[model samples]
Target chain A: MVAKTRGMKIVHSIEVLQHMLNRDERIGRTVGFVPTMGFLHEGHLALVEQARTQNDLVVMSIFVNPAQFGPGEDFEAYPRDIERDSRLAAEAGVDVLFMPTPEEMYPQDGGIRILPGPQATALCGASRPGHFDGVLKVILKLFNIVDPDRAYFGMKDAQQLAIIETFVRDYNLRTAIVRVPTVREPDGLAKSSRNVNLSEKEREEAPVIQQALQKGAALFHTGASAEQVEKEVAQYITEHSSGRIDYVSLLAYPELTTSSETSREWILACAVKFEKTRLIDNSILSVFSKEFPTQ
Target chain B: MVAKTRGMKIVHSIEVLQHMLNRDERIGRTVGFVPTMGFLHEGHLALVEQARTQNDLVVMSIFVNPAQFGPGEDFEAYPRDIERDSRLAAEAGVDVLFMPTPEEMYPQDGGIRILPGPQATALCGASRPGHFDGVLKVILKLFNIVDPDRAYFGMKDAQQLAIIETFVRDYNLRTAIVRVPTVREPDGLAKSSRNVNLSEKEREEAPVIQQALQKGAALFHTGASAEQVEKEVAQYITEHSSGRIDYVSLLAYPELTTSSETSREWILACAVKFEKTRLIDNSILSVFSKEFPTQ
Candidate 1:
């Protein structure tokens, strides 16, 4: 169904989204895509803002992809507010809001999976198995349907940004993956859909996720070993937050592997369980690449 | 380097191919692609022919992807005759020959892998581990480089054709996968580049591969169970050929999974090892889909 707002067109089916994209392509319009799982956080908005700045038409997809959620995970409880999300998207300069049903995304026989490679095996991958595969599969579906010139993702999920970059490079997927810096609050907590799941007490403690990463980034900048940076982040999270620690990892940036490359950046990432909610955050541990040639 | 003959233009880089394809797209030209490893056979020509007929511009890529071969496999020994292949492709009505080096296809820091799921775990996938993953990875690279409206592949490698279809469906790949029928010699031997590796004795007996598939298809048409069809095919290959049997599998078409849908076709496939060389063949076992309701 085609539902219209002041600036944004809300499209529900893949057929309609593809049609709109095809017409846009024909008319020489550069479409930018921002894919999200509803909730409409500042991190997602930052992605949309980047998309809007870079392209003629900005398309946002708000589907809580079930394929990305693990068994016993919060797929059922995953926060979704389409009405609020649509209004936020419209206000944020999104041209088309694609909200597809799971059936529309999946086929009848069984669902499709975009299995991740070596890059998807570390950090969050360990605790949340098959999470990235499901993410990549649905994102690929969105990319094909929207056929955007550029797709935006927050670097908050630095591993995700890296995996998406690798997927685009590996699969020769045409979309340019644009990474927006992680959007955070004044206290430095990373904006997330799961943030809503945090209790008031957990919310106050969750900034420790970001504080730990910032601390690790500071340590990495001081020429500490990746192992040392990871240990300090883990220790800080365990001590400061009222949360059970899941993982504290330092990885080769974007590759998300334990391996290191001398001339590249690393990501210091951590995930912690805040009561029933899990919060994650990361920072560029170091910039030894050409981006920081002076370093 | 640009090599030209009549309507055929041969380009040596992915950049040039993409540029040409983009220019073609800008002018509203439809592109159809056929990707093959060099040592062009009648089967490859059939793919090119289909591609040429279906689209305004037909691009044929000849790169014997090293990624698809296992450690001891024929990556080094895989046949290559660029002059012969180029001539064949041009004669087959190919508009562009996008031949690239192996280095161009793979990255230095470990290449991209399109890992196959349940559909890839059976048939040839069992004997040749990581083969379909490589096939899909390269094909995806080619699809990205070419950006074809439709890409042609032969059903002789039914597993490959099925996997590609599944890949396209799974990944939401933009290019349509066109399956050409298995092309065979007068005696029913399916054309293959590796046929050169077959000994004269093996060559004579290789037709049994297709003959067995023909027998299997005949049995399948008679309402035989998938298991029975596989058994007869395996028995015929074992009895007649000098080759050691790798596998004789019959599974749901375009899925290659054992789980079948009522409105789907099955594929009877077999692979045999003739000394160091391997040969494969298949037939559409049955069709009960709505598309073939009369059948």
Candidate 2:
């Protein structure tokens, strides 16, 4: 079935999506894709906007991929609002919206698994095992179904961005991964689907995750050891917010390795669990640099 | 480095192969690919020949893919003669022969793995755990680099072909999988790279594997149960050849699932160990059919 509004087409089947994309390719149209677990926010729109500006066609897929969520994680509790998401996507100039069911996305018991190497061992990956593997699985399927020239991802999930980039490079995928900076609120809280789960006070306190990471970034620029920066960030978050520290880690930026060296790029990343939600934020900085590159 | 002979281009790197294929695609040429572990035989040549006839360009990859080999499973002793393979490829009308070194193919510790499901629980997968996972890893890399419109596989690797088909369908890969029949020697032995490891006496006995499979197929047509077919095949191999029975099994075709009923198509397959080599063969048969489908 196809639903249309403001000339934007919403498709729910892989066959229909591929049929449309095949026609687009035959006519020499370049596609830019943005994949999301649907709950419309400014951060996702930013990715859509980039896709719109860069290609002849912009395709966005809203799939709450269950494969990526671990047991006791937020798979069931994850927010999904297709109606709002479609409206936001149409407003952002998305040409086609692919909203596939879990059954449609995974029709069989797929024996193949796309696992992360050591690069996934730290940061968010350290806490969320098989999370990036599920991410890579859905992303790979989306890339194939859409056959996009380029795909868009947000820097909010910095570890995910790194893993996807590595997956693309290692697999020799034709789709170029375009990283969009994390979108934030006036109070500097990173926009996320899970933000809706936060209580009013927790929402007010969530911005401290970012604040703590900035402090860690500053410490890193002063040539702080990775361990020291992590400790300082953890202490800051514990002291400043009504949130428990999940993890605060400063490691080699994309490689996500634990090294004592302060000679290269580093990612100051943290996760804090409020009463109802866990929020993650990160800042990438080069050694001795005054600026937070991702902030 | 590019080595050319009789219009066949031999490429040693992924970048160079992609560059050449990109040029060909820009001008709108359909590519057909055959990926093989080298030491070419009539079976590989047959795949290349089909690719030649079907597409404007034919690409063949000869990578032994160490990942697919288990410990003590001939990773080091696996045969390789690229010079001879290239000559055969040229004679068989191959357009590009891609031969990459192990280091070039692996490059890094790839965290990604492609696994098999229940379909791989029997046959070759039962005897060799993680074998198909390694096969998929290399095949995916090759498919990405080649980006062929159609990729060819032999039915001699019936289980592998089935798993790859499932992978393609599950992932929605753009490439079409072309199944080529298994090529065989005059005595009905399936041509294999490991056939070289067989002694002269073992070589003479290898064809009995195929013969026992045919006999099993005949038993299956007489409304025999899967268990009965398997028992008869095992007995025949043990009685006729000096080879030891590795396994003799009957399973639902492609799915490789066991069922007591004999109403549909089934694969009667067997493996035998003769001194230095293990040989496998199979025949697909419908219930009460008088013919061995693959023979």
Candidate 3:
């Protein structure tokens, strides 16, 4: 009963989650989900808040899935603070916190592949081999566990967002996928739990990543071609920032295809390495030709 | 209303399936799913029968997924008779026959990869690059689509069944996975629709594939080592059978690992190519020793 008011329920097992979810005899209660690898940040909170505002019950999962991490890719170093995450989640008005341990999540002899398609091969997909697979797999597991009416993801990982969208469409998952705008700091640095790992200097240089993306967006708005936009952004970041540019490309929005002729809306997405930490950000640019005749 | 009696519902979209499932509000309606590439045969029917007996609803999907087949493989020539499949499904008491097209399954921008683990790298996985990935992708899609309470798979495709079981466990999917015994013909040939394409001599020699597996099982029954059993079976198939011996080995049941000593329970599995048609089969052997101690 106390859980109903605060909308709080903590479920670790898939069976228990399904059992509790079945209590909703009527379809009136809309379930919202926010899946994270714990070590929650303001960006995660933004997603939770969005879910809380839109849905009746919010389920947040804190799982640092190993499958998504490639060999020697910081599976162990990936931050986890469940007590703090739970407190933050409760404050964010999450109805349930589905925190399952790695063993609980992936039982012995467990093997399932949730491969995100071609969208996986590009962007982060190219950087991390099994990363998107892990992302899709864990999210899918959570999706089944929560069976949320709506699921929220951040645009901070724009390609991840795009891949998830493709998965939902391809699998025809029942959950309504909602993409909330990327949450950022006052300095325009994209909010990430990973930001905590950054030193003062790295944190200071982080905003430059956002600035480069913004500049790219501005260039696209000024009638620059995609190649020109990418080159300018890449050069600016290389000169003005200490971060190593992983990739800088202008792609068709949602589709994520690289094209120079910007006849339609597109996204300028990129990932940069500040120290050993990798940070990603993106901004959408709606391209329109000024010479178009009125229909 | 008519579909309800048969435990069948015509859900036009994934949204509708979720909406109706949401209304059920009870976790008791255990669903048993049978995913197929259509062109249903008795081998498939056996799985359906097992599902019907065990679960509340039997949902079968008819999809010839392109992702699972190799470039020069039988993707184009893969047998598909949907109209006939539907009628057979209805006769099998299938609650819902999910018929999704390639476009329906994979969106224009979709990138899916459901890779099976190391076990996938052996046997069929080694032969077909990205085959298990495609198989996994479609299976994951089906799992999301049906959200079944239980899923039934045939042991005829022993490696596939093993990989799927691995996926379900690894992902912590809630569906109760039930594997049915492999169905075979009177002559010990594994029932496969591909058998239709076999020439008369090839069809007659096909039973030798199963015979070879049985020989291994018999060797285990006679207290032979796994290595000896595997060697004998491989030799028997190679020497006697007209088909090209793809693989013949004695493995631990469920685990699919090669063992030196024979245990009470082991699987004798093999794959053989009789011309263009590939046949696979396995039999479980229960080994007993005269010096065994009582529990």
Candidate 4:
């Protein structure tokens, strides 16, 4: 049956999804997937829309992958609106909506861990022990289950995006990885479902995250050293925002390595805590050499 | 073209395989796979015959998986006879003889590392740091590429088999793992292509590995404690055989945990060194109360 704009199939089990996918006869149809935690925002919608435009079949999975979340790290508090997500995905012309629960995604007594090496362990991997392992495991699971021709991920989660790319390359996954630009709010705050949980005061201050990233990006253009750029960004966020600065540093883009000179591809990433919510943002920073005209 | 014996078609790449296994087609055929490193032997052929009887289409992959070998390991020295292997496989009714080069299998740069966790660090995992990681990586790649209904593994590599099972369970792989009993020589030496490296004297002493495991199994049958069984096995191999004992122990089957009293399922495993060659062997030892005649 064709999934209309309003009603679509929601598969909770990997087996069920595989069975359904196996029944579809369109051999040449290019499949696109957008894997997400249950809550949906305009940023997620943009990803779905991009997938819809690029692929014959668009699959949007709303799984709050438990593996990606650290213990006492907003797993339970993570915003989720499946009904609204379904409506939005349908409006975006999604063909399938995979909504697997933690139990459905992770089998009982299953201890298989996929560790994305150095790339995972540098930035977020340093802070979280098994974080990227969880991310890689779930993403690999989702990729296998969906068997998409192309998969889309937002650049907002720059480290995660990079790790996924490495996983696909290392494993020789057949799916193409399409990275979309980060979607932001009018006030410069990155659009996230978690932003909905912010109190009025925290919400007002959330814009400072984007502003700090912008400032870091600007300083990088002035041939500033990575250390100098980081100092300025951290100071700006501390002075203007009510949040506690978790970390602010300029590191190599995709590689996530700490580099001094603004050459080739690099990123200025920062994380800040506002009461209970932790927000993160990053921007590409590089020298405007022949290799990278826009940088 | 239909395979003369089973009417199954031979396919090489993922595209060809998936073309045959189209979504709308009725997959009435049972697909069984035997992934190998070419240089086919009686042991590898035995696995193929088992697959032939158990499945409608028997796919035998002859790829010397580079991911499984260390930098100094004999990946290049590993024997290969593809033309001869193909003839033998076809004689054994293999539907597809998948022969892929190292380049074809791992097209990407060798920069990235895929790490399978803690379970990989126990026993052999300790001996070979990233050995099992390479095995798991290549096997997972083959599993995804083949997408077989059932995959066959010989029991000769007991630890490797256990790791494969762990991978399938942990990754929620849909393929069924069909483990075959280890094929052996008349003198009790387990058949391995690597056995070719053994000199005449080493070859004669090779049977000692099997003898140690059998002795350990006998001890378990006599209601001996795991510790006692291990000591007896190690002592016997050391005193009787010209080969040096690498390891000998009675442990929990599959889990590899050391045990004193033989439980429901136990593994009497041993590894020995004959000159420069290393040989390993194990047998399942099951202990049942006298009251339970069935067990």
Among the numbered candidates, top TM-score falls to 2
What C-alpha lDDT, on a 0 to 100 scale, does residue B260 get in candidate 2? 30
Give the Cα-based TM-score of candidate 1 against the true structure. 0.90
Model 4 Cα lDDT, one tens digit per residue, A1-295: 2334466676677777787776244466778999988678888888988998989888889988888888888889998777788888888777788887778877654255676666765655677778877788888778778888899999988989988887777676768999998899999999877787788999998898888888877877777677787888899999997998888867777777664344478878888888878888888765564232222
lDDT tens digits, residues B89-141, model 4?
Answer: 88878877676667667766524555655556555666677898778888877
Pairs of residues at least 3 apart in sequence or in different chains that clash in candidate 4: A253-A266, B67-B134, B226-B260
Report the lDDT tens digits of candidate 1 across residue range A1-295.
8999876899989877777777325566788989888899888888888888889889888888888999999999998888889889999999999988998888643333457777777888888888987887787778777878899988888778888888887666788989899888898888888888889988988888887887877777776776787788888888987888888887777666666545377777788887667888877755753232221
Which lDDT tens digits does candidate 1 get at residues B71-185?
9998988888988888888888998988888777665433334577777788888878888878877887787778778988888887788778877876677789888998889
The best-first sequence of candidates by TM-score reads: 2, 1, 4, 3
Q: In candidate 3, how many Å is residue B58 off?
A: 2.5
DockQ of each model against the real complex? Answer: 0.40, 0.52, 0.44, 0.34
Write the residue-wise lDDT of candidate 2 on B78-138 in tens digits.
Answer: 8888779889999999999999998888887647677778877788788899899888888
The regions of model 1 sitting more than 4 angstroms off are: A23-25, A109-112, A225-228, A257-259, A287-295, B23-25, B109-112, B222-231, B234-241, B257-264, B287-295
Docking class of 1: acceptable
Off by over 4 Å in 3: A1-7, A11-15, A22-28, A66-81, A109-129, A201-205, A234-244, A260-263, A275-278, A289-295, B1-28, B75-84, B107-109, B234-241, B260-264, B287-295
Q: After superposition, how far is residue B144 of candidate 3 from its true place, in Å?
A: 1.6
Model 3 DockQ class: acceptable
Error of 3 at A250 (Å): 2.1
lDDT (10s digit) by residue, model 3, range B1-295? 1133245554435545555555355345677788888899887898899898988777787788898889888877677776677778888888777766687667554556566767676666667878888887778777877778778888788788878887777666667778788788898887776787788888877777877777776667666676787788888888886788777766655566654243345567777887777777887765555321111
TM-score of every model versus the real structure:
0.90, 0.93, 0.85, 0.85
Q: Chain A TM-scores, one per candidate?
A: 0.93, 0.94, 0.91, 0.92
For model 4, state the Cα shift of residue B47 in Å.
2.1
Candidate 3: Cα lDDT at A240: 85
